[model samples]
Target: MKKSLLMLNAILLLTAVSCKKSTEGGNTGIIKTDSSTTIVTDKNGKVDSLSESSTIVDVNGKKYEKTDFVYKATDGTLVKVIFKNDPKESTVAITSNKKTFTLPKVESKGGETVYKKDDMTARVKGDSLHLEQGNNIIELKRTKI
Candidate 1:
């Protein structure tokens, strides 16, 4: 009887050990927040995080959303454009090569938005960015990243 009981216990122990849950490919080091923030890390302590916030601004007595766009020029230059629309006024900040230029919204009609500062004018239409400064015109394509 003792020998049979010992064999049964050994079999139960083996079954329990074999039925253990797997921890591979699970959310071991991922963090999320309510404000659309996500952080991912691996066992080696390398972390990658992204956070985006929803911003609403009132422009011309109407609500508009603040947005950002990144465009790449033909020469591989990157330009960052941030739009802040307020009920009273709208503006855009264009940054490239460590320089930033803030321009006021001069026109927004027919699916095209135009911002101007001094002799520089930027026009955004769909996924394309057109910049004009004096006699030079630079065209940029929108980047998804």
Candidate 2:
């Protein structure tokens, strides 16, 4: 009985130590496999893989709403966030050029998909979105709805 109790105690102690150590590890933000193209934010919320996939998440590491999508644009092309409020109204908002652009309109296409001669292409697959312009590419990964 004593031997068994000692073993149990040792196991419990080891488990507690391991758990504490694991939880104490650094909290690095999001990560991407394609280092050359993807860029994860310092808060681990947004990531751009540049290859063809990107991810976006909230401060809590939860993904943003809407499916992943990509867009290519020429240098100096200022992208404005437009709301597809019916086919006639869309608001424009200036955002940081993080390479990976987030879309507020989850279902807005604006009648066209590709922008010709823009030196940029937006690609969407599953929960990953990528935007490529010239040699610059941005990826955003969606973690939530």
Q: Please report how far candidate 2 places residue 131 from its true position, in Å.
A: 0.5
For model 2, the stretches where C-alpha displacement exceeds 4 angstroms are 1-85, 88-94, 97-117
TM-score of each: 0.57, 0.26
Candidate lDDT values, in order? 0.67, 0.37
- Candidate 1 has an lDDT of 0.67
lDDT of 2 by residue, 42-133 (tens): 33456534222333323344433211222223432323222122243222222334333333323326332332224655554433345567
- Window of ten residues with lowest summed lDDT in model 1: 28-37
Instruction: Report residue 52 deviation for candidate 2 (angstroms).
Output: 22
Q: Highest TM-score: which candidate?
A: 1
